[model samples]
Structure formats: C-alpha cells, structure tokens
Target chain A: MQITVLAGGVGGARFVRGLLSHLRTRDDAEQTSVTVVGNTGDDITLVGLRVCPDLDTLLYTLGDGVDEGQGWGRAQESTRVAGELATLGVGPDWFTLGDLDLATHLARSRWLAQGLTLSEVTARLAQRWGLPDRGVRLLPATDTPIETHVVVDDGEGGERAIHFQEWWVRHGASLPARRFTVAGLGEAKAAPHVLDALRTADVVLFPPSNPVVSIGIILGVPGVREALRGTRAPVVGVSPLLGGRPVRGHADACLAPLGVEVSAAGVAGLYADFLDGWLVDDADAGLRYPAGAQVRSMDLLMRDTEGAARLAGAALDLGRELSPVGAGTRGPR
Target chain B: MQITVLAGGVGGARFVRGLLSHLRTRDDAEQTSVTVVGNTGDDITLVGLRVCPDLDTLLYTLGDGVDEGQGWGRAQESTRVAGELATLGVGPDWFTLGDLDLATHLARSRWLAQGLTLSEVTARLAQRWGLPDRGVRLLPATDTPIETHVVVDDGEGGERAIHFQEWWVRHGASLPARRFTVAGLGEAKAAPHVLDALRTADVVLFPPSNPVVSIGIILGVPGVREALRGTRAPVVGVSPLLGGRPVRGHADACLAPLGVEVSAAGVAGLYADFLDGWLVDDADAGLRYPAGAQVRSMDLLMRDTEGAARLAGAALDLGRELSPVGAGTRGPR
Candidate 1:
C-alpha cells in the first residue's frame, strides 16, 4: 500500500517505525511507498544555527541512526556542545544540542545559507545518512521557517511566548498555553513532496502525535490541511490519548490549555470533519467515532518495532475498510 | 614591569602555560602584566562557523579543559559530528572535529555573527573559564579577517588555494606551497592591545611555534611587527627548530619545500632583523645566532607545567640580558 503518514515527535517516529515494519514484510519493499510529512514544531535556532529536532529525530529513527535509549537525538551522542553552551552561560540548559547532532544543524545552516530550501537541505541530509531509499520520502511541513511557539499566561495575568521545544521539552507542557502559533506557517507552501504525496496517497495515516502542537502545526501550514481534506485517499488518525490519558506525550497538558479534551472522543472530534477512520486503544474502544467515519480498536502501546508494525497493520486494515472499494484493501490499491 | 609574548599554535600554548606557571610561582604576578599576542593564521570558516583551533587550544589549555591525551581538542570528546558529516558525504574529513570542541566553535560562530571583534570575543570567552586576573590578556594579532591560505601546485600544473587548516591538518602539509598569504592582512588593523602590549612592554618573547606559518603570520599583520621593532622593549625569541629538527610540530616538513633549512639558524634568520636574543636548545649551544642577536641555550622541552615554567624563566632571563647593559627584566626587574 502507498501510505502517507503525518507525524510529530517520538510518538510519531515510533508509529512510523511500526508502519514501515508492516509494509516491509508485505510482499517486497518496492510494492509500498511510505511518505512522511513531518512536523517542524520543535525546531529551534541555537548559537545562530537552525535545529529541527523533530525532523531529525524522525529521520534518524527511520534511518537507523537514532538513539533508541533517548528517543531523541543520535546514538552514542556526546555533550560537548551542551557543555560549551553551559560555559557560555546560555539559558534553557535542560534541552541540549549534542556534538554529533550539531553537525546536522551546521550542514543544514550552511546549505540554507547557500540558498537551498528546507526541503532541499533535508533531502541532502538524508542522502548523506544513506537513508534515502527507506521506502519513505520525508518532507518538512513547509519549505520555510515555521516555528511553533506557545503563549502562556504568566500567573500574574500576563502572557509570554516560548519556543515550542522550551514548552515541550524543558517545561514538559506543565503549564496551560493561552494559544499557540505555527509562526510563519500562513505564508509557507507545503514542501513539494508533502503536497505531491498527499495527492498520490492511497491512504493517509495520522500517527499518535500531539493534537495541539505536532500534527496541529502541520495542519496549520497553509496548503497542508486543504491537501489532506481534498485528497481522495481515506485519512485514518491514531489516537495519541488512550484510556483518557496521553499514551506517552504531553497531549493532555498541551490540549487542555487549548480546550482540547484528552480522549479518543476528544481527538476524534478534533479531526471529525476530515477523518474517514479512527484507531483508538483497546482500552478506549467504548469511544464513538463521527457518523460516517469507521472506528477500530487495537493495543496502542508501540513498545518496540514489532508492536509498532502490528498496530500499523491494524490501522491499515481499518484504513482499507474505510477506503473506496475500488482504491482500497491492499498494495497501493 | 610588563611582559608580552607573540604566540602561535601548540608551541605557543605550551610557552604561555609555562610563562603563567613561572610568573605565578617564582615572579610577582601582581607587578607583572603578561599579554599574549596570538596568530589567527589557522582560523578557518568551516561550515560557516569560524574556528580558531590555535586560539581555542590556548584558551582550553589555560582553562584546564584541554584534552591532554589527544594533544589537542577537548576532554571527553566524541565523533558524532564527523560521523554524521561522513553520512552527509561532506568532504575534507581528515581532521575530525570532536563533539565537545564543537561547542566552542558554535559559541564563537554565534558571537561573530553578532559583529564582535575576535579580540573582544576572545576576552569574553576567557571570562567564562573563571580565569584569574593576573593582568593576563590574550589578544589577536589583528581585528580583521586574516586567513592563512596556501597556494599549492596541483599535479596538473595549475595551482589551487587551500585553507591553512586543510593544508596542515587534512593534508598533513604533504604538498608544497607555491606561496602563503595571511590573506587580507594588508588592510587589517592590528588589535589595540597587540600594539599596546608591544609598546609598553619592557621585554617581548616569541614562543617556539612554527617559525613560518605561526609567528611569521603574526608579523605579517600590519603594525604588529613594526610596533615590536619600534618599541623600547627587548625582543627575545625561542627557536622552534633545535639543531636540524623541529622541537615539535612539522616545522621541517613545512619549511623544506620553501628552501628554508629546518635548524636553529634558519629559525633565527626568520627573526634576525628584530630579535635581540635567541634561545636555542642545549643541543644547539654551538649554533651561531643571526646578525645582531645574542644566543643562549636552555632545555625547552616544556614536558609539563614546571618545564614550561622553567623555559619561561629562561626566556625572561634572556630578555633581561638583551636589554640595555644591566637593564632589569620586565616581570622580575
């Protein structure tokens, strides 16, 4: 099947890993194409270099270079960059830039400085990593600088803007957000591959990413939501919140501030107008889906690649069921 | 009394380490001011980040953060950047940039983007290491960009310009240089402290760095050499080449192609016009000094801090002897 998955951070990476496992074992790799539209919400500029942590994490996880233990950053990473930043007394010490990871930002920064678009830069980076042929085409949400930032009300009745990573990684989404912005997304064009994949997709799956941030930020990019909404493909969303709680991420914390409920029903409602099918955890099978959208239940904990593939397969089955009988069922049908 | 030293890379850092050791223990640091004028010849703008390996080495060595095992770079380093770069297919990977050392480059690169002069940047970076106030200042030779590049004759009979680092660290100086340029030094202004230290010093010392690329590049910076020559201070230098071999570094390899002998005499000739005294190794005690310069012999190994201190003391003594008959030393006058 030709699957197009919209993804966020760690949860998204895990989901995609599972999806890849499912597709790879079905016939041969060439029979299926998985294109990922990755969120750029957690991107940050540190020491004058642009760092897209979410994009990199997805790439590394998919390319077999990710640190399995950390869930973010590269494996066998060193803290040289972080240590140096500490010596300089730069703030936000909790979120670090690894030395090896810094190389990616440096190369990306250099390429962008040379006038390459984010999409082009990402392609070059992926090529270098020998990750180009992974049956997946990774695309940034947009081909421009679009940072997701949160505005939180300071306890004394004032509000402040924080970079999304600072709110997500540093603060762990403990505080309520007044609002959030995918800054500069209004003018950003969906990266070439992103729009192309959506148009050609047989099925579009939403990995269990954050509703208020991750996947939300991608949808905020001007042409993206329209593309998904207009595609002939059946779009299936996997619930990030299972059993009334977030599976792993801070979706509850991020959603509550935006008045989003942390449940399958809440998430389904958020995407009801676009979702053709919904995949909730077995624990949340009691939830209901929109009138015409198909509903399914499965073990949602993607603890490993095997489990991820299994859930991915289940989600795909539901997607096939929801897809038009002529363009659904199997193998890019 | 104030003392000033013009320095370059490995040898220069070792000399300063020794000078600091000697001055702090045997001489009165309170009454003595030591300003080190460092070469920026080896600075390279790699991946759009300006990296000054020599200056960083000195800073880290002095700050007690140097990776003594590798002979350069930082402690607890990793190869994530290089490994990732290789994955990216970036070239010129012969010289590895350790993860920890990358932090220094990132911080420096950010500051350069902020429009700070390298001298000012160095000063600010110095403060972070909790450096002691012993009237010690590490000043750059010039405030402008002075990249030391080598013109090498390609096998095809044409010449190509290579950055000094690539030529030195990457190629291991295996190729012959048609010519070298401290590029753009003609229009560059000598940093304020460089001239001030030279003018106000009772004695000036040259550390045993590469006679051509290191100390030679410093002199090429306009106003710097003139300031040293025009000052009332006694100028003393240590021979990087002891007997017919370099005390350390690839002095012989770099100088041989230029028809410069790799011996104490060749090193003395490079500074004959300005030097008042020259320090050769005890092994080269019989070696003659260049015109108008007095010759002295000492153990210049600088194996450890104490050895460096001993060498520093020897240089100070030579400075005293070269001063007007019976004239006192700068730091221990």
Candidate 2:
C-alpha cells in the first residue's frame, strides 16, 4: 500500500512519526510505502539561507534526531551560530537557528543556488536521514519559491504584511492578522511526483496539520486540490482541534480570519469535498460533521510516542473501513 | 597622519594589530589613522556563502576576537556547523567553517545579496568590530568579484585551474602551479576610497603578506599600482621572506611559478617601482637590494603581539626616515 500524507511542522511531523511506528508493527510493513508532501508556505530566507521549517521538522522527527522536549529541531542542538549572528546583528534575534539545524539550511540553500529544485535538495537531505531505507519519501508541496505572509495593522489605520514566521514564531501568532497571503501559491505547480503521490495512493492521510496554513497551503498549489478530490484513495484526517482549541500552535487564530468555527466539525468542513474519514477528540464526539464523511471520535492527545502510535492506528483503521470493497485488500493500486 | 597598508590574511592582520599597539604608545596616536586595503583574491563562495578569508582575518584579529593560536577565525570557536555539513555531505571536508566564523560569512553574503557593495558591507562589519572608534578602516582591494585561480598540471599532461583556496588550504600549496590567473582582475577598478587612501596618505606600509597572491593581487587592480607610483607619501615594506624562507604560508611555492627568487631582495624587487624603504630580517641585512630603496634590518620574527609591535615599529621608523623632509610631519598629506 502507498500512503500519501500532507503535513506541516511539529504536530504533523509527530503524527507521521507515529504512523510510521504503527506501520512498523503491521504484517505488511515491508509492502507499505509512505510519501509525505510537506508544506513550504512557512519557508523563509533568513540570512540568505533558505529555511523550510516544516520540511526540516519532518526530517528530524522521522530520522530520530529530533529534540524530544521541543518536538522539533536537532537533538543536542547548540546555538553557537545563532549567538554569533546575534552578536553581529545579522539575523532576527527572535528566530534562532541552532548550529546543527543551520547545516540543513546551508545545504538546502547551496543546492538551490546551484539550480537544483527543492525536491532534489530534499531528496539529498532525506538520504542522510536514511528515509529511503525506511520506505519514506519526503518532498515539498511545490518547488516554486513561496512564502506565507500575514497582513496586520501597521498602527496607522493601514495594513502591512510581514513574513509568516514573524507572525508565528516572533509574535506567537498574537498579532491579530487580518488575513494570510501566500506569495506564489497561485502560480506554483505541485512539485514533481506530488500530484502522482496523491493520485495513486491507496490511503491519503492529513496528519492534524494546520488547515488554514499548512494543509490549506498545500491544497492551494495548482492541481493539488483536484488530485485529492479525484484520487481513488481513502482520505482520512485527524482533527487538529479539540473542544474548540488546538493541542498546540495557534490554530484558532489562523481560523478566526476565515470566520471558521474553532472546532473539530468546522475543520472537517474545510475538507468536506474530498474527506472520507474524520477522526476527532472524544470531547467533540457529539458535534455534527459534514455529510458523506465517516466521523470517528478518540482520545486525541498524543502525550507520547505510544499515544501517537495509538491515534495513528485508529486513523489507519478508519481508512481501512472507508476504503472501497476490494481496495482495502488490494496490492499497490 | 594617514597611513595606508596593503595586506592579506593572517600576517597582515597581525602586523596591523601590532601597528595599532605601537602607535598607542606614541604621542601622535590620536592624530594617526590607518586605512587597510585587503586582498580579495582569496575570497571564494563556499556552500553558497561568500568567504573573504583575508578580510575576515583582519576583522577578527583587529577586533580582539581572533583565535590567537590559529592566527585566524574566532576565539573559542566550535565546528558544529562543519561537523553537521560533514554528516550531510554538503561541502568539502578539507575546509571547515567554525560556527562563530560562519556568522560573519552569513552577514556578508546577506548584505551583498541585498545590493550592498563589498565595501559598504565591510563598513557595517567594521562597526561591529569598533574599527571606526580606533580610527581604522578596512576596504577590499576591489568591489568587483575577483578570484585567484592557480593553473596546475592535471596529472594527464594537461593543465587545469582551481581556486586559490583549494591550492592553499586543501592541497597546502603542495601542487606545482604553472601560473596564477586572477579572474576579473583586468577589468576590475579599485574599490571606492582605495585609490584615494593610497594617493593621499602620508606613509604606506606593506606587511609580510604573500607577495604573489596577496599584495600582488591587490596591485593587479586597475589604478592601484599607478596610485602607489604617483602618491606623494613614502612607501615602505616589510619583506615577507627572511633567509630565503617565508615566516608562514607557502610564499615560496607561490613565487616559484613566476620564476622569482624566494628571497628578501626578490620580494623587495616586486615593489621596487614604488618602494622607498625596505625592511628585512637581520639574517638578510647583507642581501643586495634595488637601487634608490633604503634598506633596514630587524629581528623580524613576530612570535607574539609584542614581537609584532616591535617589527611594525621598525617599518614605521623606516617610513619616517625615507619620507621627504616636509612630507613626514604633514597632517593627512
């Protein structure tokens, strides 16, 4: 079976890590291949180095090099480069690049500057992390340079736009953004193999990524939404929200501008056109979901790897139930 | 009085630091300002970041942030970024960038990409190092991108060119070179203020930097050599060679391709067209020098800051003695 996952940074990385862990215990582990399409909307050029927050988190988390406490970045990371940059006043003080983490940006930036596509750079980075050996392929949603910007009041009754990172990382998403704008989303084609991964997958998973910026940004890529809606795969997603609140990050703040309710059902509504199975926290089990979507409720708090694996197992079970009659048992389709 | 110095990396930086030390003990210290024109031939883009080895050495050494033992890079540096790059197979393993040192390149590369000239970027970097406060200004020889390429036998009866850094750092200059070709040198104009610094200075000094690749490359810039020849200031130089041997670096190897003798007199001859005074080690005190150039002998081994200061003092004294009667005491020429 080929599983395609759309993911963001921390929460999404953790969910996919759990899914991989869950798959490891299955009889068909060797037969299962996973393709992850990572969101690149959070990408920013910091100090002339390209930094893909979501892709790096996925690489670190799955490679077993992630900081368990922070759920992102490298384990045993040091901030020597960041400290030096601060002393030189080169980059923003709030967004620190760890010494170990900087190597990723440096490699990515170097490769990109050499004219290699982002997908090519990601593949090279993935090799170092042994992703291929684990039957995992990570790719950016789009190769085109795109960045999410947040429009906010400039304190003069006018609006101004700041890179999403400043809004998210620096301001903690508390800057009351009027709206989110992706610079190149409309023109960006899905990266190589991205549409194919979605179109040909047996199961398509949305791993609790931010609906407004993460998965939404991926869907904004040309042909991506159509691929998801047209794929023969059973599309299952875990809700990022529970009891009108997100487990982490400022999901509510992101949804507020769109006037979407900050609830599991509201998030499910965002994917109503293509979603097959929807898993929500037990606290929101009574909420009504979109028609044609199979709603399931569970204890969604991923407190540890084991808890994450359990949640992933439930999502896979839901995907199996939603799969068409002969599709669930069929070989690579 | 204005003093202009033509310099390279380690040796030049140490000499200038020593010169600053020597001047501090003089009553006219507050009245003297130094302008250092650093070689850009050693500059290379590594891992997509511009690395100005010579200029960085000057900054770190003069800023009191240099690794004293290595004579370059930052103090208390860590190679976490380099180590990570190695793990990712990002750059040449032969060259390593310390975490603290990488920050300087990042800032420089960033500023350059943002449309700032190398000289403008250097000024910002100098501000951080408190260069202005010390009445010191460091400028690249030319703002136009130029790199020294070493032509060497390809071990196949053919000749190929490699970056000067690869020759100097990677191969340790062990490879026999046919010649040195500086890309962009012919078409490059001297950096803003560089020609003016030389033309209007009261005195000029050459530190014991490599004659072939350092001061030689700077002189190769258009108008620079002419500026030196026409300048009213007395030009004095410290020989890079003593007893037919360089104190550091592969100066002999660099001079071999040009068919020049690797001796104090030979190095003095390279600057004979404008050189008014020449200082050599006590061992080369008896060597024959070019006509019209004043010769002085000194214990020129700069084993420490004090030793460097003593040697700098000797060079300064030679410049004073050789200066035109009215020129030596003039203010800023």
Candidate 3:
C-alpha cells in the first residue's frame, strides 16, 4: 500500500513519526511505502540562506535525530552560529538557527542557487537522513519559492503585510491577522510526483497540522486540491483542534481570519469535499461533522511516542474501515 | 599625517596591530590616520557564503577577536557547522569554517547580494570592529569578484586550474604550480577610495606579507601601482623573509613559479620601482639591493605584540628618514 501524507512542522512531523512507528509492528511494513508532501509556505530566506522549517522538522523527526524535548530541530543542537550571528547583528533575534541545523540551510541554499529544484534538494537531504531506506520519500509541495505572508494592521488604520514567520515566531501570532496571503501560490506548480503521489495512493493522511497555513497552503497549490478530490484513495485526517483550541501552535489565530470555527468539526468542514474519515478528540465527540464523512473519536493527546503511535493506529483503522476493500465504493472519479 | 598600508592576512594584520600599538606611544598619535588596502585575491565562495580570509583576518586581529594561536579566525571558535556539513556531504571536508567565523561570511554574502559593494560592506564590518574609533579605515583592493587560481599538473599529463584556496588549504601548497592566473583581475577596477588612500598619504608601508600573492595581487590592480609611483609619500616595506625564508605561509612556493628568488633582496626587487625604503632581517643586511632605495636591518622575528611594535616603529622611522623633511626628495613622478 502507498500512503500519501500532507505535513507541516512539529505536529505533522510527530504524527508521521508515529505512523512509521505503528507500521514497524505490522507484517506488511515492507510492502508499505509513504510519500510526504511538506508545506513550503513557512519558507523564508534568512541571511541569504533558504530555510524550510516544515521540511527540516519532518526530516529531523523521521530520521530519529529530532530533539525530543522541542519535537523539532537537531538533537544535541548548539546555538554557537546563532550567537555569533546575533553578535554580528546579521539575522533576526527571534528566529535562531542552530549550528547543526544551519548545515541544512547552507546545503539547500547552495543547491537552489545552483539551479537545482527544491524537490531535488529535498531528495538529496533525505538521502543523508536515510529516508529511502525506510521506504519514505519527502518532497516539497511546490518547487517555486512560495511564502505565506500575513496581512495585519499597520497601526494607523492602514494594513501591512509581514512574512508569516515574523507573525508566527516573532509575535507569537499575537497580532490579529486580517488574512493570510501566499506569495507565488498561483504561479507555483505542484512539485514533481506530488500530484501523482496523491492520485495513486491507497490512503491519503492529513496529520494534525495547521489547516489554515500548512495543509491549506499545500491545497492552494495548483491542481493539488483537484488531485485530492479526484483520487480514489481513502482520505483520512486527525483534527488539529480539540475543545475549540489547538493543542500546540496558533492554529486558532490562523483560522480566525478565515472566519472558520476553531473546532474539530469546523476543520473537517474545510476538507468536506474529499475527506472520507475524520478522527477527533474524545472531548469533541458530540460535535456534528460534515455529511458523507465517517467520524471517529479518540484520546488525541500525543503525550509520547507510544501515545502518538496509538493515535496513528486509530486513524489508520478508520482509514481501512472507509477503504473500498472493507465497505466503501472505490469507483473512478 | 596619513599612513597607508597594503596588507594580506596573518602577517599583515599583526603588523598593522603593532603599528597601532607603536603609534599609541607617540605624541602625534591623535593627529595621524591609517588606511589599509587589503587583498581580495584570496576571497572564495564556500558553501554559497563569500569567505574573505584576508579581510576577516584583518578584522578579527585588529578588533581583538582573533584566535591568537591560529593567527586567524575567531577566538574560542567551534566547528559545529563544518562538522555538520561534513556529515551532510555539502562542502569540502578539508576546509573548515568555525561557527563563529561562518557568521562573518553569512553577513558579507547577504550584504553583497543586496547590492552593496565589497567596499561598502567592509566599511560596515569595520564599524563593528571599531575601526573608525581608532582612526583606521580598511578597504579591499577592488570590489569586483576576482579570484586567484593556481595552474598545476592534473596528474593526467595535463594542466588544470584550481582555486588558490584548494591548492593552499587542501593540498598544503605542496603541488608545484606552473603559474598563478587571477580570474577577473584585468577588468576589476580598484575599489573606491583605494587609489586616493595611496595618492594622498604622507607615507605608505608594506607589512611583512606575501610578496607574490598578497601585496603582489594588490599591485596588479590597474591604478594602484601607478598611484604608488606618482604619490610623493615615501613608500617603505618590511620584507616577509627572515633568512631567505618566510617565517609563515607559503610565500616561497608562490614566488617559485614566477622565477623570482625567495629572499629579502628578491622581494625588494619586485617593489624596486616604488620602494623608497626596505627593512630586512640582520641575516640579509649585507645583501645587494636596488640603489635608489634605502636599506635597514632589524631583528625581524615578531615574537609578540611588543616585538611587532618594535619592528613597526623601525619601519616608520625609516619612512620618516626618507621623507622630504629629512633630506630625501619628495617630488612629482
């Protein structure tokens, strides 16, 4: 079976890691291949180096090199380079690049500058992390340099746009976003194999990532939404929200500008057209979901690797229940 | 009074630092200014970041942040970035960039990419080092991207060119060079203020730097040698050699391909056209020199800052002795 996953940073990375852990115990582990399409909306050029926070998070988490405490970045990371950059006043103080993490940016930036596509660079990076050996392939949603910018008040009844990172990292999303704008989204084509991954997958999984900026940004890519809607695969998603609030990150802040309710059911409504199975936290089990989607409730707090694996197992079980082999029709779109 | 110095890396930086120390003890220190024109031939782009070894050495040494033991780079430096790059197979493993040192390259590369000339970037970097407060200004020989390439045997019975750094750092300068070819040198004009610094100075000094690659490369700049020839200021130099041998660096290897003798007199001969005074070690005091230039002998080993100061003091005294006020002619070219 080929599983396609759309991922963001921390939450998405953890969920996929859990999926891998769950698969390791299954007899068909060798037969299962996973393709992850990472969100590039959070990409930014810091100090002339391209930094893809979401992609790096996925790489580190799945490679078993992620910081367990932070759930992102390299384990045993040092901030020597960041400290020096601060002394030199080169980059923003809010966003720090760890010494080990900087190597990834350097390699990515150099390769990009040399005219290699982002997909090609990601593949090279994935090799170093042994992703191929684990039957996993990581790719960017789009090769074009697309960035998510947040529109905010300019403090005098006017509006201004700031890079999403500044809004998310520097301000902690405290500034009310009027709307989110993704620069170059219209012109960006889905990266090589991205649409194919979605179209041919047996199961499509949406990890508990930010619906507004992460998965939404990926869907914004040209043809991506159509691929998801048309794919014969069973599309299952774990809600990022529980009790009208996100467990981590400012997903609520992101959804507020879009006028979407900050709840599990509201998030499922965003994917109502293609979603086959929806898994929500037990606290929101009573909430009504979209029609035609099989709703399931579970203890969704991924407290540890085991907890994450259990949640992943439940989501997979939900996906299998909705798969054509079980009961649902797998008719051509 | 204004003093201009042509410098390279370690030896040149130490000489200028010593010159500053020597001037501090003099009564006219407050009335004097110094300008340093540094060689850019050694500059290379490593892992997409511009690395100016000579300029960085000058900045770190003069700013009191240099690694005293290595005579270059930052103090208390860590090679975490380089180690990570090695693990990722991104950059050359032979050349290492310390975490602290990488920050400088990042800043410089970003500024350059933002359309700032190399001179402008150097001025900003100098501000961080407090160069203006010390009445010192540092400038690159040229703003154009010029690199020195060494033509050596390919070991397949053919000649090939490699970056100067590859020959010096990776091969330890052990490869016998057929010649040195500087890419973009002919078209590169002298950077802003470089010619003026030479033309208007009361005295010009050549520190104990490599004659073939460092100071020699600076002279190769279009108008620089002409400015020296036309300037009325007495030009004095301290020979990099002690006893027909360079105390540090591969000056001898650099000179060999040009068929120049690697001795004090031979180095003096290279600058005979503009040289007004030459300072050599006591061992080479009896060597024959060009008749127009004044010669002085000294215990030229700079064991510490004090010894370097003593040598700088002697060089300055020789310059003053050869000045028009002290019986030497100071007329138009």
Candidate 4:
C-alpha cells in the first residue's frame, strides 16, 4: 500500500513512525511504501544556516537519531556551539540549537547555497539517514520559502509580524495572534511529487499535527487543496485534540487566531471540504462532524509506539472503508 | 614600548604570551602596546567556516582559552559536531574541529558572508574574546586568502597539490614537498593597520615560528617587506631552530624544499636584509650571522610562560642595543 501523510514537527513524526510500525505487521507489509509531505512553514535561517524544524524533526525521529525525551533534535546532542555563539553574541539567545543538530543545518545550507532546491536537499539529507531503506520518502510541501508569520501586538502600540518560530518557541505562543500569513504562499508551487503523491496514493492521511501551521499550511499551497478534492483516493484526518486540548504542543493557541473553536469538531471543520473519514479521540466522541465525512472515535492517546500504531491502524481501516472497494489498496511496492 | 611581532601558530602565540607577561612587570609596562601580525597562509576553510590557525592560536593562547598542553584550539572542547559530520559524510574525516571552535568559525563565516573583511571579522572575534583588554591586537597579514598549498608525490609517481592542513595534519608532512606556494599571494594586499603598525612601531620582532611558512608568508605580502625595510624601527628576529633542529613543527621539511639549510645561521640569513638583531639558542652560539645583523645567544626554550617572558625580555634588550641611542623605548603611559 502506498500511504501519503501530511505532517508537521514532533507530533507528525510520531504518527508517521507509528504508521510505519503498523504497516510492518501487516501480511503484505513488504509491499507497503510511505511518502511524507512535511510542513516547511516553520523553516528559518539562523546564523546563516537554513533550518527546517519540521523536516528535521521527522528525519531525526524516523532515522532513530532523535532525542527521545524531547521528541526532537539529535540524541546526546550538546549545546557547546550555542554557548559559544552566545559568548560571541552572534545569534539570538532565544533559539537553542545543539552542536550535533548544527551539522545537518551546515550540510543543508551548503547544498542549498550550491543552488539545490529544498526538495533535492531534503532527498540528499534523507539519503544519509537511509530513509529509502525503510520504505519512507520525505519531501517538503514546497521548494520555495513559504514561512508562516504571526501578526501579534508589538507590546507598544501597533501590531507587528514575527516569524512562526519566534511566535511559537520564543514567546511560547502566549501572545494572542491576530492572524497567520504565509510570506511566500502566493508564489510557492507544490514540490514536484506532491500532487502526484495525492493522485496516486491508495489513501492520504492527515496526522494529529497543528491544523493552522502544519496541515493548514500544506493545504494552502496553490494546487494542493484542488488536487486532494479531485483525487479518487479516500482522505482521512486524525484530530490533534483530546477532550478539546492538544495531545501534544499548543494547537489551541494556533486555532484561536483562525477563530476556530479548540475542539475535535472545529479541527474536522477545517478539512471537511475533502475529508472522507475523520477520527477523534474517545474523549471527544460527543462532538459532531460535517455530513459528508464518516466520523469515528477511538483512543487517541499516543502514549507509546504501540498506542500510536493502534491509532494509525484505526485511521487506515477507516480510509479503506470509505474508498471504492478495489481502489482501497495499492498494486505493488 | 610599542612592539610589533611577526608570528604564526603555536610558537608565535607562546612568544606573545611571554612578551605580554614580561611587559606586565616593567616600570614602563603601562605605556607598552603590542601588535601581532599573524600569518594567514596556514588558514583553511573546512566545512564552510574560516579557520585562522595563527590568529586563533594567538587569541586563544593570550585570552586564556587555548588548550594549554596542545598549544592550540579551545580548552575543554567537545567534538560532537565533528562526530555528527562524520556520520553524514559531509566533510573530510581527517581535520577534526571541536564544537566550541566551530562557533568561532560560524561567526566569522557569517560576518564574511555579510561582506566584512577578515580583518574586521578578526577584530570582532577578538573583542568577544577580550584580546583588546589584554593589550594585544591581532591582524591577518593580508585580507585576501593566502592559503599555502603543498605539491607532493601522489603515491602514483605523479605529483598532486594538497592544502597545507592535509599535508601537515593529515599526512604529518611525511612526504617531501616539491615546493610551497601561497594561493592569492600576488593579489593579497596587507590588511588594514598592518603597514601602519610596522611604520609607527618602536621595534619589530620575529618570534620563533616556522620561518618558511609563518614569518615567510607575512613577508611575501607585497608592501609588508618594503614597510619592514623602510621603517626607522629596529627589526629583530629569533631563530625557530635550536641545535640545528626546529624547536617545534616541521620547519625543516618546509625549508629543505626551498634549498634553505635547516640551521640557526641559515634561518638568520633569510632575515638578514631587514633584521638588525638576531637571537639564537646558546647551543648555536658559535654560528655566525650575516654582516649587517648583530647576533646574541640565549636559552630560547619556552618551557613555561616565565621562560618565554625572559626570552622576550632578552629580545627587547637586544633590539634596544641595536637601535640608535634613545630611539628604542616608547614614552610613558
């Protein structure tokens, strides 16, 4: 089966890992292939190095190099570089980057400076982590910069714009965001294989990533939403919330800016136009979804890999049930 | 006294530290100022960050951040970034860069990318390290890259050119170099304040650094030689060799390729045209210097900071003797 997943940072990585784990146990597991469309809205250049937080999170987590405790960054990473940078006063003191993590940024920045596109650089980086051997392919949502910026109160008089990272990481997303705007969205076209992935996949999944910044940003790309609506494959989404609160991260803070209620029903409403199946946590079973979508409530607490796999398995089964009988499965590996 | 030292890497750093220490105890020390013209030929860009071995050697050694036992690099440094880079197969495995050291390079590279000259970048880096507060000013010989390349036997009966680091650090300079050439030397002009320091200095001393690569490369810069010869200040040089062998490093290997004999007298010959006084170890007291240069013998082993200070003091006294009466020492602070 060819499974295409739209993902964000830590949460997305966890879901993808669980999906891969779930596929491994299937009778036809050897024939299964996964392609992940990673959000690039959180990307930024820090200290002259291009850093794609979401893509790196997925790559490190899936490649078995992630700091398990933090669910992001490299295992056993040191902040010596950050400390030294602080001494030099070269970069912002807010964002803390680890020494081992810097190697990836350095490599990516060099390759990008040599004129490689984001998609090409992502492939090169993934190749080093042996993502291909694991039957997983990761690509950015768009090749061009499509950085998300939040409009927030400047604490003086007028409102000002700040990069998503500063808004989320530095401020802890505490300040009320007036709205979110993607700087390069109007000019950004989907990466080469993105539309094709939707067109050819047996099923497409939206992991429990932040709706506004993650899946929302990916869908904002020009032809991406149209492609999803036009594809014959069933589209499914899993709620990032459990009992009206995000299972991980501050999705409610993101949702507030869009005036969307911080509930499973509110998240489902954002994807209702094309979503064929929607899965909410059992805690949110009382909530209502749109008419055309088939809603199912399951235990969505991804407390461990096993729990994550079970949730992923539930989403896949829902997708299979919604798709046309023979079209539910992919032909071969 | 205003002192200008032509220096490179470890030896130069040691001499400067000692010189600083010696000045601290002098009655006129408060008036004393020192400028170190560091060799840039040994510099290399590894993994996109500029690595100035000579200037960094002086800065770290003087600023109390150098690995004392090694005479170079950061004290208490970690190689986490290098290890990660190895895993990614990004840069050559031969040149090991520590995490703390990489911060300096990254800062420099970022500044250089912003169109800051190496001299400006060096000053900024030095400021952070508090080199200025230590009464030391470090400047590159030239702003343009003057990397030393070695032509060596490629082990297949044909000659190949490799960077000096690869020749020295990787191969341990085991292969006999056919010749040494400085890339961009013809185009490289003296960095800002280089000629000015030489022009207005009370005395100029050549530290016991590699004569062929360190002090030699500095003199190769177009106007530097002219400034040294034309300056009214007395020029003094200390032999890197002691008892017919280099005190440290492979100065002999480099000198042999240029047909310069690996001895104290031979080293003094290279500087005789500009040098007024020369210092050598007591072991080489019998060796005669060229006609115009006065010679002195001393115990030149810088076994510790105290020994280095004493040697520096002896060089200053010798320079004072060579200068026309009342022309050597600077006015009071």
lDDT of each: 0.80, 0.92, 0.92, 0.90
lDDT of 3 by residue, B1-333 (tens): 789999999999999999999999999899889999999999999999999999999999999999999999999999988987888888888789999999899999989999999999999899888888988999999999999999999999999999999999999899999999999999999999999999988889999999988999999999999999989899999999989999999999998899998899999999998999999999999999888899999899988889889998898899888887641334543
Which 10-residue span in candidate 2 chain B carries the lowest summed lDDT? B324-333
DockQ of 3: 0.84
Tell me each candidate's TM-score. Answer: 0.92, 0.97, 0.97, 0.96
Candidate 1 pairs with clashing backbones = A1-A331, A1-A332, A18-A308, A80-B100, A128-B87, A128-B88, B18-B308
lDDT of model 4 at position A50: 92
DockQ of each candidate, alpha-carbon based? 0.65, 0.86, 0.84, 0.77
- For every candidate in turn, the CA RMSD to the true structure comes to 3.1, 1.9, 1.9, 2.4
In candidate 3 the C-alpha lDDT for residue B265 amounts to 94
Which candidate, 1 or 3, has the higher TM-score? 3
lDDT of 3 by residue, A228-283 (tens): 99898889999999888999999999999999888999899999999999999999
Cα lDDT of candidate 4 equals: 0.90
Model 1 regions lying over 4 Å from their true place: A128-132, A282-289, A327-333, B25-27, B67-70, B133-135, B253-263, B282-290, B298-305, B325-333
TM-score of chain B of each: 0.93, 0.98, 0.97, 0.97
Task: List A-chain TM-scores for all predictions.
Answer: 0.95, 0.98, 0.97, 0.97
- Listed per model in order, the count of residue pairs whose N, CA or C atoms clash below 3 Å is 7, 0, 0, 0
Which 10 consecutive residues of model 1 chain B have the lowest summed lDDT?
Answer: B324-333
Shift in Å, residue A262, candidate 2: 1.2
* lDDT at A84, model 3: 71
Residues A1-333, candidate 4: write the lDDT tens digits: 788999999999999999989998998788888999999999999999999999999999889989999899999988999999999988888998899899999988877877899999999889988899999999899998888999999888899999999999999999899999999998999999999998888999999999999999999998999988877788999999999999778899999978898999999999988999999988898987777889999888988888889989999999888877643454432
Candidate numbers, best TM-score first, in rank order:
3, 2, 4, 1
lDDT of 1 by residue, A22-74 (tens): 88787646778788888886788887888988789888898788999878888
